[model samples]
Every structure is written in C-alpha cells, then in structure tokens.
Target chain A: MNLRRKKLWMTVTLAVLAAAVILIPAPALAANPIERFVMVEASQYAFTPATLHANPGDTVTIELHSADVAHGIYVEGYGVSAEAQPGQPVAFTFVVTESGVFRLRCSITCGALHPFMLGRLTVGPNWTLARAAALAGLAVLAAPLAVRRETA
Target chain B: MNRVSLLQIPWLKAALKNRWPQFTISALLMAGFVFAIVAGLVGTPVGSRNFGIIAVWIAWWAILILAVVPVTGRGWCSVCPIPMAGDFLQRRSLLGPNGGRTRGLNLRLPKLFRNIWWQNAAFALMAIFSAAILTNPRVTALALIIMLVAAIGMSAVFERRSFCKSVCPVGGFIGLYSQVAPLELRVADAAACASCASKACYNGSEAGYGCPWGTFPAGLTRNPACGLCLECLRSCPNDNIVLNLRPFAADLEKPAARLDEAFKAFLMLGAALVYAAVFLGPWGNLKVAALAAGTWPWLGYAAAFLLICLALLPGLFWVAVRLAKRMAPAKPHTARRHDFAQAAAALVPLGLAFWAAFSLSFVFANGSYLLNVLSDPLGWGWDLFGTAGAVWSPLYGSWTVAVQVGVLALGAFGAARVAQRAGARGGLHPLPVSGYSLALTVVMMGLLL
Candidate 1:
C-alpha cells in the first residue's frame, strides 16, 4: 500500500482498538450477598493487612486495633471512620456501593508519617486500573504513528 | 516557527525595565521565606498544621511545578528570594548597577566544578533525606537556613549567581525542564549584538546589573541557562534584546551535548519513580525507613535511592542505547557516549510529567492544609483568616488517579516525539527509548492508580 493509505489504515485500526478497550464490559455482579470481617492493626506509621477486598454491595466490617498510639481509620469514598485506642478495638460496618479502589487513611495524627499512613480498599475488580493500563498501552503504540519521520 | 516578542507590549516592557516591581516581589517572597523559617523553628510540631511545611512544600511546590516551570521557563528564578540576600551583599545596592562598584572577591567559579555536577550531587543529597525534611518542620527549617547561607557564601566569593547556576538543587531540575517551556529571552538582532562595543548585557552599564545568570545574549540558543531576569533588556542600548513566545519544546530539537545534563534527566526520572513508591505506595516499611533518617534502615534506603538514580536506571538506559545501536547503527558511526547523552533529551518531558503527576496526588490530598496553616501560621492558634478550625479533607478523591493517568499518557507521547527526533539524527532507534518511557509510565500508573 502507498504511504498515505497505509497511514490512514493504521489510524483507523488504532481507533478501533481504543474503542474495544474502553467498551469492554465489566464482570457481572455476584448473585449472592456476603459479609466480610477484617481486622486491621494500626501502628506508628503502618496498617497491618494494608489492603482489603470485598464484592460490590457486600457488607464490610472493619475492626481497627491500635498497636501503639491512638489512631483513627477513615475510608475514602465510603466516608466512614472509627477510632481505636491502645488495647481497644473499634469496628465500623459499611456497604461497598461502588466498584473501584479507595484509600483508607489515618484520621488522627499518629507520627511523623501520619499523613502517608494508608491502606487500600478494593471493591469488586479494579476496572479503573485495567482501563488505565489499556489506554497507556495504546498511547505507546499510537505515538510513533503520530509523528512524521524527518531527515537529519 | 514564528516568534512574538513580548517586549513589543508597552506596559510589560516598562514594568520589566523598572527594578522596583521585581524588587518588591522578591522582598515579599523573602519575608515569607523568613516567616517560614521562624514558623518551622518555633511553631507547632504538626507538619500538616505548620506554615513552614504546608506553604513551602504544598503551595509553592505546586505552583512551581504545575504552573511556573511549564509556562514561564525559569520565571521563578527571575524573582527567586533565595539569592536576593546574596545579590544585595555582593552589589551593595538593590535598585541599580551601583556604578560598577561591586564588592566581594568576585572570583570566577573553578573550571572543574563549573558544570551542574554540584547541582546533581546537591539534589541527590537532599532527596536522600527528603522524607524527614518534608515531614519534620525543624528539619525543613534547618534545610532552608542551610540553603540561604550557602547562597550567600557562594555570592561572597564567586562573580555572579554561581549558586543558582551550578549549585541549587531545585534550580537544577528547573533548568533541565525549562527546555520545554515556550517562552525564551533572546537577541532580536544578532548583528546588533556583534557590532556593539560596550556589551552591557554581560557587563554593568549603569542602567542595570549584568546578567545574573552569567550568560551572553549573542551566543544564547536554549532556555536552560537563561534565567529570564531581563537585565539584558534593561541594559541594552540598541533595543536588541527581546522575550519571545515560540513553540513548546523548541530547544529539544537540538540533542543534549553535555553529560551532566544527561545524568540530570536520569536522576530526575529515577527520583520520580522512587518518590512515588515511597510516598504514595502502600509500602509502610519504606516510609518508616525514609523518615527514620540516619538509622541503619535509613542508610540502606539512602544507598538504594542513590544507586537507583545514579547507577541502575542509567545502566538500563545505556543497555537500551546499546541495543538500539546494534539494531540500527548510525551510518556516520556516532560515538556511544554522545548518543547516550543525546538520547537522554527524551527523558525531560517524561520526568516533568512524572513530577507533575506525583505532585497532583500529594497536593490534592494535602492542599486543604494551606487554609488552616494560613489562619494559624505558626500554629499558635491565631485565626487570622478564620480558617484555623477548618477540617482536614482530601480533594478530588479518586479523580486524582484519572488525572495522573492522563498526565502520564501525555508525557509518554511527548517523550516519544523527542525520541523520534533523536532517532532521526542517525545514532539511536526511537523504539527502545520510547519503550523505556512507556514502561516507566505504566509502572507510575500502577503506583498512582
């Protein structure tokens, strides 16, 4: 094929591939409801079992235990918080209404790295990450075709 | 391809020529800098509530990376306050040239240490201890004071702005990425500059001080060395100096020729990766080690940080360059060292993007602290703005991840274009370099998302 025709074909193919990636259907929801109980230990600047997973619409009961100082666990997207003192465990229950990754941060000042003390709550599959990965791959593939070759 | 001279605008030209406006801005910033030092030393130990930490790290850092560097190209350096005290001590007059009666030894910077190697080392040293300096207000205060004293000391001995040009850590990265900014200060008529005998731009002519950055306008071709101080414009008798708006990344069309600058790209890119993993990732042990500062784990962390920035990343890139050479050798047989430096130009955009993306997450999460700190600057419970009681909250939520992904994608594309241009110069293949950028982007995305 001629150069112009070849370029046109490549552009069209890339567009189709991008659409396929973006339009891919998410996994079907689970038919039965379930309850997940997780115990998270909070220390000076870390949370034990830093990541928690649950299905969308499932009830998640998180019991926070402070191993050292006073600490509070606040979940982003859920907007629920629980405070636990040393030797005392506080629990909060929230329904996972969405299907994305959320950060669980320390609501109370703990130490020097208090702001960065964090954990992840994943509900269902992390499709945002999957889609971002796909888009990034497509971006790398599309880059060379976007610029014309120039002679030195 | 076309350039519009900003000097043609009457009021801007007048404002730039007048030293008062620049001096006033620098003075205000210096006051803020002094206040930050005081706040850090005596204020509340809470880093989130301390003005020293929130204002400088969050507010100023966001503005420098997201707006100033990308839009103005070393514009921050034009009025930077760190060098103001030094300039004052050296010149003995702030308003004008002082009739060329400057003080100090006025010795030239040594030939061996003239390049940005000092800047690279200084920046690495700071990065190794950044977790502590970024978190503890006292450490931040000490770091700021050290920088201030270093600038004054360099100015007391060196001729002009040797600290900013070759020593300042932040200035080093700003200079490297300024190559992508659209704005440039250049001579409108090179012939005018060549014919002029006084050459007031580099030497004081009573109208203004000489180029603080120590660059000659006639030989200027890129944005890395030009601080955009406009001294040349104030001192030019023939009206030859002009600030122009041109295409972005215009300077990267010419490949990098210096090894120090090339290593700067590697260092910055590696820093972004390491910072993301340490600061934004869920690795708690890493954070502890980074903040422990001078302990065994911290020492190990520091060693790994330097090794990654100085050896591992650059080694991998060199291997890529070697692979490219084998895959597509230059017809004219370009030297490997030259090709390595030239190919590093592609990392400038990628590094800038990585920093911007990382800053977005950090800024959005902690930006609200700026309000509280503004009201209670010293955290002594003074509510100047009635925001001292403001609650802490993260802004934009999960949208930050989406925005970070978009920024990284744009950066990858820009880097690919630069790599393609470098490949066209006959030494390197674009694929390996572009692949390197793409892999880093994916890893960064994984970290942020």
Candidate 2:
C-alpha cells in the first residue's frame, strides 16, 4: 500500500477501535436485582471485604464493624457514610445506581495510613476498566503507526 | 516543530536576568520550609492534619508533578528552597555575585562519584522509608533536616550545587522526567559562545554567578543537567542564551547514552507500580508491611521493592531489548549496552504518566487536608484561614479514575512513539519495548482502577 493509504487505514482503524471500546454496550447481567447484605470488617488500615459486588438497582446494606478503633466507611459516588465503634456495627443501605467501580474510604482518622485505607464497590460489571484497557490497547497500536520514520 | 524563544519577551527576559524575582520566591519558600519543619517537630502527630505532610507531600507535590515539571522543565529547581541556604553559605551573598568569589573549600567532586548513581541510591533509600517519612511528622521533619544539613555540608565541601546535581533524590527524578517537558534553555547562537574569550556561563561573571548545576549551556543537548536557574542568561556577554518553548518530549528523539539513566527510568517506573499497589490498592497486608519500619516484614517489603526496581524490572527490560536486537534485520554488531540504554528511553514518558496518575488519585483524595493544615499548621486549634473546621472530602471521586485512564493511555501512546524512534536510531524492533510499556500500563490500570 501507498503511504497515504496506509495512513488512512491506520486512522480509520484507530477510530473504529476507539468507538467500539467506548460505545459498545456491556452485556446485561442484572435481570433479577436482589438485596445484598455485606458485612465489612474494618481493621487498622484495611477492609475485610476489600471489594463488594452487586447488580444495578439492587440494594446494598453494608454493616461496618470496627475490629480495632472507631472507623467509618464513606462510599464514593453514593455520598453515604456509616460509623462503627469497637463492638457496635453501623449499617447503611444504598441502591446501586451506578454501573462502575467506586472507592470506599475510611472517613475517620484511624492511624498513620488512614488516608490510604480503602476498598472498592463494584456495581454490576466494571465496564470502565474494560473500556479503559481496550482504549489503552488501541492507543498502543496507533501510536507507532502515526510516527514518521526518519530516513538515514 | 518550530521553537519560540520566550526570552524574546523583554519584560520576561529582564525579570529572569534580575536576581530579585528568583531570590524572593526562594526566600519565601524557604520560610515555608522552616515553618513546616517546626510544625512537624511540635504539631499534632496525625499525618493528615500536619502541615509538613500536607504542604510538602500533597500540595507542593501536586503542583510539581501535575504542573511545574510537565509544563516547564526544572521550573521548581529555579526556586527550590532545599539548596537556598547552601547556595547562600557558599557564595556569601544572596542577591548578587560578590565579584564572582566563593567561600569554603570549593573542592572538585571525585570523578568516580559524579554520575546520578548516588542520586539513584539516595532516591531508593528514601523510597524504602517513604511510608515512615510520609506518615510520621517527626520522621518527616528529621528527613528534611537531614537533607538540609547534607546540602549545606556538601556545599561547604564540594563546588557549586553538587548536592542537587549528584545527591538529591527528588532532583534525580525531576531531571529525568524534565526531558519530556516543552521548555528548555539553550544557546541561540552557538558560534557566539564558541568565539567568546571568556566562558562566563560556566565560570562566574560580575553580572551573575556560574551555572549552579555545573553544566555548560553551549553543550546542552538535553534538559537533565540544566537546572533552569537562568544564571547563564545573565552571565553571557553576547546574550547567546535563549529559553525556548519547544515540542514536548523533543529530547527523547535522541536516546540516552548512559546506563545510569536507563536504570533511573526502570527505578522510577517500578517505584510508581509499587507505590500504586502499596498505597492505593486494596491490599492491607502490603500497607502494613510497608509501614512497619525496622521490622522483619518491613525488611521483606524493602527487599522486594529493591528487587523489583533494581533487578526484576531492569532485567525484564534488558531481555526485551536483547530479543529485539536479535529479531531485527540490522547490523549484528550493535553494542548490547547501547541498545538497552536507547530502548530504555521509551520508559521515560510512561514513568512520568504513571507518577501523574498516582499523584492524581492521591492528591485529589487527600487535597482537602491542605485547607485544614493551612489554617492550622500546627494543629493547635488555630484557624488562621477559617478552614480549620473543614471536613475531609475526596474531590472528583469517580472522575479521577477516568482522568487516570486518559493519562495512562496518552503516556502509553507517547512511549510507543518514543520506542519507535529509539528503535530507528538503535537498529532494533520497537515492538518489545512497546509491549513492555503496554503490559505495565495494564498492570497499573489493574492496581489503580
């Protein structure tokens, strides 16, 4: 192929791959949404159940139990929080409205690594990771093709 | 791409040539630096609430990684406070050159210890104990004091800015990644520099001191050694020096020719991956092990970290380069060391992007502490800015992940382009390096997202 045709082909291929990655719908897996009762144990700097999974429209009731000191769980994207003492467990319910992964951070200063203490809440499929990976692959494929090879 | 000389602007050139602007900024930052030490020494033990941790790590670090280094190479070094006191002691004057005289024993650094190997070691040491220094206020203060004293001692012993040039952990990575930045300092008329009787840029003049980083401006083809101090601009008699705005990563067209720099690329990339896994991932045991300083677990973590950075990553990259050389239909006599170092240049952009993505998540999540710490630097119930009562809140929660993905994608793309260029120059295939970068990006994505 000529240089112009090769360039055209490369551009078209990249655009198509990007669109397929971004616009393609994820397979529906939540036909029957149910309630998920998850008991999360919070220790010095970690969550017992590091990741929680639920389907869209399903209710997730998280019971936060502090294993050591007073700790709290703040769910990102949901903007809801629950606090628990050493023995006392605090529970909060939120509907899984988002279809991506959100962080669960410690709302209280438990220790030195308080800010780093984290967990994840995955509602349905994590299409964000999938799409991002696919886009990254597309970028890698397209980058070298776009560069002009310098002649000696 | 065309280069626009920022020195063409009269007022900007005048400001840069004058000593007051740089001096004033450095002085103010030095005051803040001292205050951070004091706060760290006496303030509340909570790392989040301490000014030293928040200001230095979160606020200043955010600006340095997200803006300063990416937008203007070595812009932070122009006003960094770490070497200010040392410079003052060495020159005996802050505002001007005292007829280009110096104080103390201005001994030359031994040639064997001249490269960035010391910097690599220093940075590795800091990275090993980063969990402690970044968390404990006392540890942070002591670390700062050690760096300050070391800089002062090095200045007293060796010649111009040797500490920054050869020992500063932060400066090492800054210099490495600064090659990707669009801004650069160079001589506009090379013949003018060649014809000049007095090389005042390296040697001091009445107008300004010599290059503090000990680099000759006329020979500069890359950004690593130049600190962007603009001393050469003032000292040059024929006005040969020009600060130009050029294409990003313009320096990467030519691969690095040193093994130390290649190792630096690997070290930084590996550090980023380790930090992502330890600090941001959902692995609690890893965090505990990293935080438990002096314990066996911490030792294990440190050893593993060192192995990954110094051995595993570089070993894997070397294998990839060797494989590429064997596969390529080029001269079989190409030097193995040359091929490896050249191909390793491809990791520079990817390493920078990894740091940016990691800093984005860390700073965005913890940036709110800046307000609280600013108001109450000592955490002594003082609300100087009325934000002491502000609550902890992560900013742009889910959007941060999206931005991280975008940044990583861009970084991967840049790395691929650089790999192709390096391959073209080194008579090797670009696929292995590109594949390595892609695999790391996927792992980074997995750790982060």
Quick one: best DockQ, which candidate? 2
DockQ for candidate 1, please give it.
0.64
Query: In model 1, where do residues sit more than 4 Å from their true spots?
Result: A12-16, A19-25, A29-32, A149-152
Using all chains and alpha carbons, the TM-scores for the candidates as numbered come to 0.96, 0.98
For model 2, the interface Cα RMSD in angstroms equals: 1.0
Runs in model 2 with CA error above 4 Å? Answer: A149-152
* Model 2 chain B worst lDDT window (10 residues): B326-335
Per-residue accuracy of model 2 over B117-193 as CA lDDT, tens digit each:
99999999999999988889889999899999999999999999999999999999999999999999999988888
Per-model i-RMS:
1.4, 1.0
lDDT of 2: 0.90
Q: How well is each residue in B40-68 modelled by candidate 1, as lDDT tens digits?
A: 99999889889999989999999999999
Error of 1 at B344 (Å): 0.9
**lDDT for each candidate structure:** 0.87, 0.90
